[model samples]
Target: MRTAIVGSVLLVAGAVAAVTGILPLSDLVELWDRVWPILLFVLAITVVTELAAAAGLFTVIAQHTARWGRGRAWTLWLLVALLATVSTIFLSLDTTAVLLTPVVVVLARHSGLDPLPFALTTVWLANTGSLLLPVSNLTNLLAQHAMGQPSPFEFAALMAAPAVVAIVVPLAVIFVLYRRSLLARYRTGEGVAVDDPVLFRWSAGVVAALVPLLVSGLPVWIPAVAAALVLGAVFLVRRRGVLRVGLLPWQLIVLASGLFLFIEALHAVGLGTVLAAVSGEGESPLALLRLAVTGMVGANAIDNLPAYLALEPSAESPLRLAALLIGVNAGPLITPWASLATLLWHQRLTSMGVEIRWGRYMLLGVVVAPLTVVLSTLALAAFA
Candidate 1:
């Protein structure tokens, strides 16, 4: 809680500094000019996705799997994670959190499993899965636009090997550690009970909202506009009472936009050029590896999106970009603050009274993240 407060304070202070000229508005304006469309697009998608989740799509999915106990719970959670990943591929990690976290919390309680693992899996895989598509994560989208890199399908194919390794290995580790509890829960026949018809209706509505986004290659704005209309109609039908369904995290949306503007200010001060120069002197695979490692470490210190924005312009090759992206996503596994998804997961866990200490989370990250990074980098270097 203290960490969240401090982080919030820092975010606000940074935004103030940027706006007041202490951080330089010229750079902020330059980036805003160039990236504002994408920013709006992301924000719109975030809003719409949140609304869809409020409609209870995850609850509906979880209910269908309630009969199988632990296996059912784990599988459902895994599917939720995958759905979050898919959502992130199109919307962004933030949107995935908005859409999935509430459902995950309910499902975790219903299944009698620790929410931490599910939360971690969602955030971690959301990062990895988003890497497979250009629209999946902010960093990937920026990289694609800035560099004219591979298409989403192309990138996903290239990342297929790493994605398998990442998901399978982590699940194995998680299962090994928690097998007893999982098995016990399975034997007990514990499962989620469907209590609310309203939730089911909402879930159906959310799925309806997402179909256009998924089936067609329509611009994000189309989905955004559709969601707004649908949500608005739902609101009018319920006479503003339905707003409680929680379609969006308005605070987070504002916070992300503000941070982006703040980082843009830093970028304008020639930080990109400085970093680019540092990156240009060497092409050693080890050096590239080190950069990726450092990026992960730095993401914990700062945040991943900002760190990516700062480092991305310096990336000289597709290989370097891949390393940086994989490293940044993997790095967040080590620290709660390393990725927005982690932070959101932490918040969700704490809200549910699930206690996972920072030390333990870091311990897991130290073990898993480096291995994932190395494997992902090798895949990228080989294929990209």
Candidate 2:
């Protein structure tokens, strides 16, 4: 497969680079200074959040809504999406997906609705809403910290228009596609009982974990430490039973952090400068459109986080960063590997016996991705 060939080529290239001393141990050491702490923090938060989520906290909330009426299916979907969005505000996308995927799968099976729409909506909302906080997305956080810019809240205010478009348009599409199924599931009786004790304990843990983010000017370590303490307490109380609760997917966290460092490597190696030269300095509509298209294409080929990080060093203005993020996020809707969130959706759907082919997903992506990027870019330019 093409993926295999590309992976092989990258491996060989990396080996050669290391042997030739093109990327020296010294260079790697310097890169670690810039990357390792962020990677560790992201991984830690991801693990703790996943543990809390798997404790059946959100599932319990979904079950309560399912008891209300059939319409609660949509409400349940919205709640998952909202939590996913909120989670991305403090945790990375990998963390959000790992934390929410299991809960979404169980809720969909219980409600008799396909999990695809719910999972996809959650992923999309996570990408959009995370743009609200500096710590929301790794790429955003890196850019802000690197540039010594203000907090993410300030950037979020500037990006409000695109954020609204990103959240609203896809939701409309999801509702239209699944309206009948949603209605049918709502009419069916509520499926199962939930464990109240586990739910309350997890809810308390989530609150305690989030306390650090609520107070401004707190060190990022505060939330990281709180999450660890809360999860440790929960595990102690649950004892051996805690192992039954899912842990975060450490592989995804590793992949995300590795890609972030790799892209930062690319930037250090002057790829961004080369890209800037090729892009030229212009603010014309055609130039902006070209940049957006290029961003989307790069994202599909490599992953949004890496694409954003690689582009960060070359971006000449805030508008460029905004455009790149919008386009990169939009393009990932097309491919399974494009975004970990989409991959998470696919995994959840598979677990529930729903298989969506790449071709079918592409059908949706072809229609929505371009429109979303174009609209998002225009909104960013107009507002920023």
Candidate 3:
């Protein structure tokens, strides 16, 4: 609701700016031209995941994962980390945040383990693990556009090194911070019963098929929309009551639209120049670090998407662009609003009765964000 209100205000402000010529009409059109496909992908993929969850697909997987853990908390934690990574890389960070957070939290509780470790793993990996593919993060989509539409494999290869570092660094920090919790053993719970077995089977099948198509070098929205429509039709037949306006992710669409316009308006007024000056110039390791740090600061201050847009012009070289990606995609771990995924993850956790103290979260993030960003950036400079 708060997000909707803020998005409404920003959307109105951007409209006013365009009407008054504070932001050029041509520029607005150009921005939409670039972003519409990305937004479409976001909406479609979100719907697909939401419908899948509603069909008990994620719960089934979580229970299976619990069984696979063999009663070791550490093993279960690692499995959840792997699941979160796979979800973030293939489905997008928002999917991991919105869908996987609850699954892992519930999985932890059902196993009689501390939910905090599993909860933190999902949210952290949702941001950091998102660096591997264009579909993993919205900023990655924008970067892919800037990079002339590289093949999904090509994009993944370029980011593979840093993406590994980003995932590992967070996992290492998590293991150390929650070593006691993770080292304990727990009893495996029984599998969750599917209320609609046919719906679950179809939804699971659609998701399995959709995952490969997402990375098949086609525009991502094609597969996402197809999967969403397939699941929508299944739900309509098997569980019409679950199909509602709420599944559309209207707030996110509105928020992203408003953000793109609002940020473009700021850029039109010379935010770009200021950001470029701050980000500096060069593909040197130090220069890349500077740009990455600048992006990290901007992301923590505002949000990752806006930070990426603000600093993108300065990242002309491929290496520098990788660095910027490292910062914006892997660096937004501190504040709740640092990335939309974090916000969504927090919301999911709260709804499931998990309470996280913001001060401790911030303190932990302050330590982990810099380490992850710096190590990941250096890994890019060294490897990519």
Candidate 3 regions with alpha-carbon error over 4 angstroms? 144-158, 350-353, 357-360
Candidate 3 lDDT over 1-384, as tens digits, reads 877788888899999999999999999998988788877886887788778878888777778888989999999999999899998998789777876886897788788999998999999999999998888888888898888889889998889999999999999999999999899999987766889889989988998898788767688789889999999998888889988987776776787678778888988999989999999999878988999999999898778988898898999966788899999988888887788788767766765689999788999999999999999988988987
- After TM-score superposition, what is the CA distance of residue 31 in candidate 3 from its true location, in Å? 1.5
| Local lDDT at 322 for model 2 | 62
lDDT by residue (81-197, candidate 2, tens digit) is 677766666665655665666666666766777777877677666555555556666566666665569656677786677777776777777788888765554544544454556
* Candidate 1: tens digits of C-alpha lDDT, residues 119-205: 666666665555666666667766776656677777777666555665555666666776665444432233444445564475466
After best superposition, candidate 3 residue 129: deviation in angstroms?
1.7
Return model 3's CA RMSD, one decimal.
Answer: 2.4
- CA displacement after TM-score superposition, residue 56 of candidate 1 (Å): 4.8
Clashing residue pairs in all predictions, respectively, total 5, 1, 0
C-alpha positional error of residue 334 in candidate 3 after TM-score superposition, expressed in Å: 2.1
Provide the TM-score for each candidate, comma-separated. 0.78, 0.79, 0.90
Report lDDT per candidate. Answer: 0.62, 0.63, 0.86
